[model samples]
Target: MTSTIARPAPDATRRQDSAKPRRETRLRALDGLRLVAALMVAAYHYGGRGGAVTEAWGSSPKVQFPTLHAFFSYGCLGVQIFFVISGFVICMSGWGRPLRSFFASRASRLLPAYWAAVLLVTAVFALPVVAYEAVSPSDALVNLTMLQQPLGVDRVLGVCWTLWAEIRFYALFALCVVLPGANRRRVILFCALWMLAAAIAQGVDEPLLDLVLMPQYAPFFVGGIGLYLVHRDRRDAYAWGIVGVSWLIGQHYVVRELWRAPSPDAFSNRTSLGIVLVVTLGFVAVAAIALGWLNRLNWRWLTVAGALTYPFYLVHEHLGWVVIHALHRGLGLASAETFVLTVVSMLLLAWLLHRCVEKPLTPRLRAALSRTR
Candidate 1:
């Protein structure tokens, strides 16, 4: 008796779908957005703080570009953009991975490039000819961990303060992933708990809780996670609401915080408004990209821009300050010309760092870690 069982077509379709690798959507526009965020941050660090030449560093040069400084004052908003992107990317990355895997991925992605930059910056600070104060050996060691601030040590670079916040966010997200399992339901629940904690912290005005919860920036991350949920499951009105509310709260926080202290330049009011505007635009753009409104922007070079952003961000600022100071004093470059040259040099340095350190080491490190696991 040759009895053959008939298989349903839906079962076959399900099997096929299950067998295929789940390739997440590659939104090239987000890559472009990364470049924009990085540039804005660089601008904020470089030009936003206007000062007299005799005051310190080389910010005296920024006075030459008052208009540029005015626009760049809003560049701090880029950090908010980055926090949102991190949330979105982390959700995407941690979707199916274990806690250890997520930790490994984050470490491999961040540490090597960071270590390389640290070494370079340390070298500069260590040299007396540079006249920058030397980084103590213990502090440098702490800096190597990239948890300097939270660990109660000085950051080797000023911008590194943001990295600790990022690490904390990653740790919190990992806990969420491990607890409830990665799913749309967990995202909503996690965000609700986070915001509730934030509200309590604000009410109590506890510094420790504020430090731990980082409520000031939690909404941005929540908004990003909400965007991911909305994208992955479009029919969820609850997720949509989470996104809308989170974005509004985050925007309000930014405006209120920054509007309090505008630079004394003529563009003070304009700068405050610009900062708020850029932040609002950032949220809208990311949401639009998440919802598939701007998915068609598939420029290959934008990937390069995105790739270089990390190195560029790490290598700019303090190092650029030193370079500008040297150019003005050592090379007889004018304020405007020194600013331009420093920017160009930093871009080239970023490209080299990406090509030499980040690109080659990240894959090998991740692979080695995976093999050990």
Candidate 2:
């Protein structure tokens, strides 16, 4: 009859409460943007420049969707969008937490869903596209770690490379999280130093340094972080300078990729490069959204679309490819029909993953992880 409930310490209560505005700033627009990015990636893998199977798929008269292919060709640009969004969201999530808390939160949010995705991918590819080759124990171990490529082993899924970049970003930001003083200023300084290191590495002709610094993609993440600062009413000359540097670097990266891209004999290299440059507008679009230029994007359906993004992204490419190949080969379906069917099937699978795996497991896993701490 004489029991008293313990309450959170005053400082801890303030820390938890102060995190609300950060959460409140979660725009439905960004979720819509995420969904758009995921769809773009799926489309890219189905018919865009990155998809190696496109030529064979398009050769058949029954499946030629020239218009659709053209639209999705620029879809790789979506990855840049995701990068920028990642910077913004990561900063928001880590704004007020201690380093360990931030790390735990990120791990809890990402790992369980990712592990499930890995298993799903393994199941889909179990029978093999060619004759079934057994997955080696070493490869399985590497895949389980999700650090296969960095460890000089093959990835379980090709798309998993982006997760490596994400890991690097998180690790780099953790340093800033652990630093003393204002989080916003610490982030700004981190961005500047990161870009400076990248510039120096490039100047010294040390490609390994470039790899470590990741100058090619750093611009988008830095730009996104800068935009968040601007959104938080912390914009100043220094912040703008960082954003400008990031934008310039991103512009250079876009041009570099275009230049290195093998130009088809059907079109001049200039024309091909120009087309790609136009697609780089995706970066601008993301920055605009962060800068409050697209504040009117509040659609509920888009929010739902956003919520499904991670699962959709995880399940889309290879699994869809499997379905496409199977339908085209066994069922004698047209490439067009197979493409449509593959997309539909992938969407249903994504929904199931979101509901059955992500939704049910994420909070429980987070709770369990908290107990460990």
| TM-score of every model versus the real structure | 0.88, 0.84
Clashes of 1: 0
Q: Superposing every Cα of model 2 onto the true structure, what RMSD results?
A: 7.1
Q: Which lDDT values do the candidates have, in the order given?
A: 0.76, 0.70
Candidate 2 segments whose C-alpha is farther than 4 A from its true place? 1-23, 50-71, 128-134, 178-182, 260-262, 265-280
- Give candidate 1's error at residue 141 in angstroms: 0.9
lDDT score, candidate 2, position 260: 44
Distance from true position, residue 46, model 1, in Å?
1.0
Q: Tell me the TM-score of model 1.
A: 0.88
Model 1 ranges off by over 4 Å = 1-21, 50-62, 261-272
Model 2 vs. true fold: TM: 0.84
**RMSD of candidate 1 to true structure, Å:** 5.9
> Per-residue CA lDDT of candidate 1, range 35-128, in tens?
7898888777766665422233343424556567667667888999998887788877877666666777888899888999988998887888
